[model samples]
Target: MPIKFEIGDIVHLKKNHPCGGNIFEIMRIGMDFRLRCSTCNKQLWLERTEVERRLRKHFRNDEEIKS
Candidate 1:
């Protein structure tokens, strides 16, 4: 099954960037996904297929989305 994520959901990515962070925010969704690094503020676009493969986990609570 494909993993699903929603806007404002906090997620951990499969790989960590050089900044030593793997967390990202699901800013946009569609044929492509737009993500923002939780630690470095870096943003990038990824294919939905690729994102599904790399999604590590979804936030269990809404605390992170409050901001």
Candidate 2:
């Protein structure tokens, strides 16, 4: 099944970002997705398929607090 995502959701990418962070926040979603790197605060736009392929895991705010 396709993963459900929302704005503000935190996601970990399978590969580390060039900025040395794997964590990102979902900024916008559609045919394309906008992500902001957690460490460097850089923004990136990627296709939904690419994002899904690279997705490692996702954590909501409550879930993040618990971890």
Per-model root-mean-square deviation over C-alphas? 4.6, 3.2
Q: Tell me how candidate 1 scores on lDDT.
A: 0.78
Q: Tell me the tens digit of each residue's lDDT in model 1 across 1-67.
A: 5555678778777988678889888899888999899899998898988887787677835543221
Estimate the TM-score of every prediction.
Answer: 0.77, 0.87
Top of the candidates by TM-score: 2
Summarize candidate 2's per-residue lDDT along 1-67 as a digit string, tens digits: 6678889999888988898999999999999999999999999999999998998787887474322
lDDT of 1 at 7: 84
lDDT for 27 in candidate 2 is 99
| Cα error of candidate 2 at position 21, Å | 0.5
Candidate 1: give the clashing pairs. Answer: none
